[model samples]
Target: MTLHAHLTRTVARPLPITSVVIDDAFWSPRIEQGRTTTLPTQEHQLRTGGQFEALSLSWKPGDDNEPHIFWESDIAKWIEAASYSLAKRPDAELDASVDEAITLLAGAQQPDGYLNVYFTVVRPGERFTDLRDGHELYCAGHLMEAAAAHHGATGKTSLLTIARQYADLLIEQFAPGGPLEGGYDGHQEIELGLMRLAEATGDGRYRALARKMLEDRGTEPFYFEAEEQRRGTPGYFGFLFPDRAKLAERFREYNQSHAPVREQRDAVGHSVRAMYMYSAMADLAPQLDDDSMQAALAELWSSTTERKMYLTGGIGADPSIEGFAGDFDLPLHGAYAETCAAIGLVFWARRMAANTGEGRYIDVLERALFNGVLAGASAEGTHYFYGNPMLSRGDMTRNAWFGVACCPPNFARLVQSLETYAYAQTDDSAVINLYVSGAATFDFDGHALGLSVQSNYPWSGQVDVTVNTAPTVEKEIALRVPGWAQDVALRVAGEDHQVQVHEGYVRVRRTWRAGDVITLTFAIVPRITRARPEVDAAAGRVALERGPLVYCLEGVDNAGDVAQLSIGDGAALRDEWDDDLQAVRVSVDGTRHLNTSSSLYSSAKDSVEDATITAVPYYQWGNRGKSTMEIWIREDESASF
Candidate 1:
């Protein structure tokens, strides 16, 4: 099935606003200027000054044979950011810098279309020897994405041609009857990327190649075992793969056998790898019109969102592997909710939402974007956190980039792509996934439509939308009323309209004139959410949730073991301004229990009773001097007089 046919049948009309253009208003002088000013890092990395130079001086060509999974991932981010910037700014220096990068990339490409500095310059002979640990395919995937982005931003085909050569090499090396048939990257990303290349270049061969790679994963001989034996279990891949027998067992345990490309569920393995694999599955599912794949994807989505998810929509609860442990294992402080994993959650959610027209997918996406992804980057957009801890200590250090700093550039790229998730489309319908104060104009089904959405969302609940186009067409507009909204009202032309709501979206179909305004109001009620009893981390605890934002108690603002803090039953949550704090603060008649005992981990004494305590939004926590923090707190069962 073609993409257009699938969209016509399943997707709603009026495509969502994708961030094709750089958001200069929110990111311009502040964020863009910051990126440019940070160019010294890029220059240093490219030449001989910063960490890259330091590594390059000691770097032997053979050293590149070792798996440096993120060696090129960082550069891919910069290329994406540069393309986005040049698309919006069209500055001469930006163009020159882009051209220069392209020139370097072109020069670096091998005669066989291979283009990775590590493998090309560092270890040429051992290029495909270590598929289990090496990121050669992963790096190629990112290059393919960057090439597509560059081609889209500018009509230039230089980078595209270079990437095409690399893709050709991949096809030749990994095809069904090629030199390497049983080998697939332990990290699954190139499949989805190669598909994108196929779409961009209109090449059926690339799509076939991508399909072959996905289908060949986890078959016979098990690629990782041979690689591990060859390398004597050296470096990060050992940690990632651990025991070859165990890894193979887990693959079979997850039912990842040789059936079809889309019949797997329950996210497993490295958090990022699982998401990337699922993303490719989603992309290919619709293109192939595979119902089994869609069903499995839906099941996986539900499992993640309904049980194995943080309030912030961040997954991966197992700190050991930095991946999902099981259902409902969300621990606060010990959580290894890696920033890249959260961003990957958004990636999977957006693709599923776009493909299925399901509001639940967008709901998860919004929660992850506003909380999970936002927590990774500072409000200033300069500093970043590799691990997005729901609760933190003052001693916690934020790394510029970790041994796996793939999260940083991934975060930046997602922020740049934020505009795309706001809207979605089908033949005769449009779905608004996010409510932001912006406007989007696009072509769908041969009709030009303009939609203006004005709202102070995440701060306020009122969203007003105005639609304008040629007078003769009728279209169905779907507005998402968030699952958190308890009471929602929709009005068209000052008259209450009967709306059909399913899966968290209110659909209003009407034959539209040039000037039609549809207003939607979602009730933002501050409510307390409790985890299921099986979730030991949140047992006997309640967390405050308003809209999609999760609230937490920070020790800097609320004194002592935030675990023991409790609010009075009749305590009213009122919004108040704190001039010193410089943000909205929540006031509650809550009492703090002082742990009189010397032992830190002791349970609350029998003498403890209900007291007044205050709570604040989790995002606003840590602004003050960090002490202790807690998202899920024990609710005192006794009522206060």
Candidate 2:
């Protein structure tokens, strides 16, 4: 069973959580926290934030509060997270709460199968009137995802029934000749969700709807243009269309629809919307055998990774559009690397990996997973930053919650389903994706299989795998040697052996025994990573990375003025233990630049002395209270100070 109902994944199938067990010290506790603390806290935030009351059918005509159009998606995500939790760890009370929410949400559905809380409770007559700003379909897509998750978690179809009714109603309303024809949700989610529903319940109608939604976009007598004409468009991108000269041309750029999806290349528009659409395209292309669609995804991957992405795997170069600006337009401090967008990147990358039998997809996935996605939440597992910036000046801090708090729950759901991303299985091979200590047992070609893994990753590069209860046939195990790893060594049965190393993984093909062990090690040395010169904001700056962890200097440890410091050289870095954070600290030789200029602008001077400062992992910052924080530093290009 795959996390997504991706029956068409060409290269590999992601074994469900039931097929694997996570027994590691690192992920076990993290998953437990998500189950106990994060899920409950999100529920409380939703309840206190008036989500239940907002969606309730008991609202009077004179109710003062108008529901947020997108409020239902938040509840949908919460139920999805809770459903994932209930699948692994059963809880009677939590189960009851989820069922209760499902019942109330169902009660709010309109007679026509349209299930939007805002239109039902707030504006009854104007349902689906403003599709661009309404978010009716967006909310439905998330609820459909929740329905699929609930079915997987509880093995029940109560929520799935609601989603089916919603899907049928949507199909009736938006079919080729229906009233909503030639229209798509301004947000790109329903396409992915429809595909999930089609897989969950073997109905081709949903997939048909999914394809129609994508196909109907960017055609002549444009729906966006017509909708903008009727609504007098005022939105940032999708809303105001006819207001432009070349209407169809510019809307495609904003919607990643310049041409048909298969023809579009560079990543564009709202970062999250574009990513969600791209992920669905990747999932559908192989099933339809559409090579052009796959080619578009490949082109997009190169454009985003090689130029637009940050060293920390963050995206979104422009804060105004909450999307990309141009090639190599990465800004350090002013960057709006939305957490949801980065998580969306993981979805796209994983699908890309499954489509193409390559390990470079895993490289991009691991980098984003370790840095950008992990940096969304604080250490306490509660506070979150909606937008993650590479540089923070003693002011950027996480909030308990936000008005549009999509990122928090979006991340919570991702953390709950970590098992699916850990490994992918094929007929004769099982790929080790992420190095969290876990024991996975699954059936391969009608034969029983068992494998156990141990690692102290990021902090240490050594990984040990034991072929416990081996397969009857020769099963090849491909271990991902991360792109960052250089000097990697592989050993079998305590004896050094050379293996066929491809793209970015070392493949060991052998028939194994229960006691047979394989050992692998990668040098865990701190190295400096520099930004491309085109990124003017980070021209002379460099960041430090060891293994998968990106290091950052906080003001509290560096005399409260982190900007005054410059990195001397990566070779001078040394590791030390930090009792406060309960993690390793890396310190490097540097110099504190003297602020000798009387005016704000002056000639650069080298009045400095030798100094050093400590740095913590990017994920560990803002825990000791807010202070100046920076990932990139002034690189000592000439010599060690």
**Evaluated with lDDT, which candidate comes out highest?**
2
- State candidate 2's TM-score: 0.94
Q: State each model's CA lDDT, in order.
A: 0.67, 0.81
TM-scores for the candidates: 0.88, 0.94
> Which lDDT tens digits does candidate 1 get at residues 156-260?
998889889988887777776678766677567787678768867878677777766766676566555666677664434556444646556664333233234
Model 2, range 1-641, lDDT digits (tens) per residue? 11122245467777787777887766787788888888888888989988887767666667666578888899998898888888888999889989989988878877767787768766676776676667778888899989998998899999999999999988878886778877888788898889878978988788778877776665666676577677664543344444665555645576665567777778887788888888888778777644887888899999888978877677887887788879988888898989998888988888898888588888888788878898898877888998989888988889889999899899888888888888888777788888989887757867766889899776788889988788778888878888888778999888898855796678888887787888888888777888778888888888888787888999988987788888765447788667777677998888888867788888778587767778888878888888999998887766564
- Return the clash pairs for model 2, or none: none
